[model samples]
Target chain A: MPKLDNYRVPLKGPVHLADYDPAATPFAHGTVKAQEKDLKMLNKQLAQLMRPLQGENKRSVLLVLQGMDTSGKDGTVRGVFKTTGPQGLRMATFKSPSKEELSHDYLWRCHAVAPAKGEIGIWNRSHYEDVLVPLVNRWITPQIAKQRYAQINDFERLLAENGTTVLKCMLHISKDEQRVRLQERIDVPEKRWKFSLDDLTVRKQWEAYQQAYEDLLEATSTTHAPWYVVPADNKLHRNLMVNTLLNHCLLDMQPQYPVDYPELVGLQVE
Target chain B: MPKLDNYRVPLKGPVHLADYDPAATPFAHGTVKAQEKDLKMLNKQLAQLMRPLQGENKRSVLLVLQGMDTSGKDGTVRGVFKTTGPQGLRMATFKSPSKEELSHDYLWRCHAVAPAKGEIGIWNRSHYEDVLVPLVNRWITPQIAKQRYAQINDFERLLAENGTTVLKCMLHISKDEQRVRLQERIDVPEKRWKFSLDDLTVRKQWEAYQQAYEDLLEATSTTHAPWYVVPADNKLHRNLMVNTLLNHCLLDMQPQYPVDYPELVGLQVE
Candidate 1:
């Protein structure tokens, strides 16, 4: 099956987000089926690539997925990563750092959870928290923390230089979109536990966070580790775009089997 | 394919483990095509049963497996958990507590990582550290630490009473068998990183640790949250036993689809 070049949207800049309205985005994309089929096919190819890489243990992939609460980070993980062989996949979801993490550098906590060689580590929320939450809370002076942006770029560049393929996604959603989601959580008895007042406070500072995110993206979007600002107004679109990026990244890695292992020739099933 | 009746091995207290070696229990179950076929069949049944239960979201399963270093924790996870659906399954591995964790109550750190409803959480090593490590290091009195075993049981009972099914495993390997495996690690450059001088130090206290573990298993294993003692002499046996126990747990849960969700009957794909 041919890959869908036409469906691939050009990388949008920060300015393009002006038209963003999560609720306004139509989820009934005409190409949903085709796109999903492509994702499945791409995932199969990725599985084939991943098998040999497990034995080689040379490179590690860090998949950093950052998004607003209820913007489908968990769903994206479920859909895209469901097929990757379990052995080499490591997932680290960062919660609030512990007291020890506060004593040292912010990156210290993240450093401990980085994926090992021949592994794929999913960071549900990662070092980006240093920028996002601290910036939102005014915990650090803008100038001092601005240095962290470069530090992060260097850190990611170091990872890439030392054989890590970093795929970062920012799941973007509008304020109105978040309100609807928050309401869904409140209204749906099953989802009540997921709702929190802090979600509303975060939604209130949406624009400030957006500008902070935009600057962070502009500063750190290296050729080695590009950040995809995913439009997450439409959950379907968010899922699709994230899957596309993941499929693309895995395909780019082109993982191959170690040559030393004995090749299966005529081994028969008993 | 039919279900294999549970393979029961009779092992009584403190058998002079130094006499028995891995060679004595070399995986003699050769060419297991039929067994493999039955396993696959059982896995499909288990997955089918688990699919809908995720939506019901009434209960979660916590699988905690611990053993001496190189006792096949990762291998068991790989073998037994291969077929679980990604949506409802999560895994958390606890290494030595970071400096931050040391300051807090031991259970506090663990609480942050517990599985949500309708999920199966796998803890590679867990809160048992409060019991095991502290006791090993003489950081706490055995009397105080023995209280922890009761605390753990009650904690699990709380989780079980409120919709969590906890299944814990202790992989039992003889000292002679472990020495052979440790030797393999030292001889093979690839596995050398896994071996450490600390492992030998721990080996010296193996009997004390074994007694500690026996007390732990005896006190904590209950009907709601039973402990599965797996023989780790043979990797294949360990893997198969783990797979069977997991199969049984998922079967017992009998997860069904939430009745609230609309049925997929005549929906158009295109």
Candidate 2:
């Protein structure tokens, strides 16, 4: 297995999307059957580890997933969390901002829902959307985007200092792979409703989105809250990699069941 | 099986807490082993039913639980949802109002967190707490409490009008049962942390609190949002009754997998 650090964006340098291979299966080189087995094992460990985290109840987790449409953000959530099954997980998916949301600063909405202590909070799409959408579409000045980056870094730093493990994964998928998935949405009756015309519009701006993602990945990948580019072209491999990263981070935290209460020794129920 | 309607508070007339038998197991008179098996089946059914409700994306469920401390409100949430496992469920637990919360009206905090569309929201305790605590302790005048009841009814009516299925349950535990449970919390080392000294202070006013619950159950039990008093002394029976009511409500709503897209017949994934 490769060092997971091999995927973390460098803190001090510009990033190029071309450097990462979206098709690489460094984390899962096994046959499809073997990969499925491995993913099942990781998922079980994640579910078990959550007991101690919520039992300890002092710290929590925030997983932020940002990716282009048809890039499997929703799929990643279901696949990665299927075994864990929301034991202490709270997922918030940010759609286009409502009128009330737009009236506030972008982070205001994000800050409001930060996981309460002891929860594993998942953001299917998050604040990074602000940086990407506006920057690509020129809705915000570059200077404002830069300011927002610094603000995001500061906010994450506070969460880290106060016991939050922030993990951000940008589901990396090749545009060709996206075309296949987008068409699948259009083709499957059960999935057809998920297809939207706006998705095609977003696909048309693919290069601009790639540039925007590269820019933000460089600007916001701080020491406290790093960005990981997950190779998400293959559905099974994407689930495996995300679950692997999640398991490693949770095990590293090493949350424990609380110590036994000495004062209640030999006490009996009435 | 006994009639589930046996527990529903009548839409008109006063509610007498003493009339309900907290120790009764009308719905689950089977052996403990059999009751556990039934609950497991119900839990699986709840998990299965969540899919079509989420896929429909039009309506949602809001379940409110109110009960005395150690009456198993937390236990009910854990036992009932242990299988559902939070796929699209959102759990919001209301504790004492924080400084910011006190500034707004009582329902403001609750209204903000009411279940989103296609989500089954579980409230460990809810705006109903406002009626119970303040009215029991005389923090609010009788006139104020009466007015708040109307406000609550209107708020719930609005939610029902907007496609939310609201079900409220009051975990009815005898004072003797509560005493045993509270003492166990005090005695068991693993459960010692859950024992709050303030709970005893509240216990001293049990009769008053019961009266408060009775008053609110009468005022707020409407056509749209009805309250059911669960006989909660037997934990298994409590779980069974609550699950039965929930399954019935969900089945009645009858959310179906959407079948709207007609444009993509015979299309194939590239």
Q: Which candidate has the top score in lDDT?
A: 2
Query: Model 2: per-residue lDDT, tens digit, A3-116?
Result: 889899999899998999999888886799999899888877988888778778899999999999978887787777765654477778898999999999999999888887
Query: Chain A: TM-score in each candidate?
Result: 0.84, 0.98
The residue pairs found clashing in candidate 1 are A22-A233, B52-B256, B52-B257, B53-B255, B53-B256
DockQ of candidate 1 is 0.09
Can you give the DockQ of every candidate in the order shown? 0.09, 0.25
Candidate 2 per-residue C-alpha lDDT over B28-98 given as tens digits, one digit per residue, 9 for 90 to 100: 95688888999989988987888788888899999999999998887888778765645578888889999
Q: Per-prediction TM-score, please?
A: 0.61, 0.87
Q: B101, model 2: CA deviation in Å? A: 1.7
lDDT of 2 at A128: 86
Number of the top-ranking candidate, with TM-score as the measure: 2
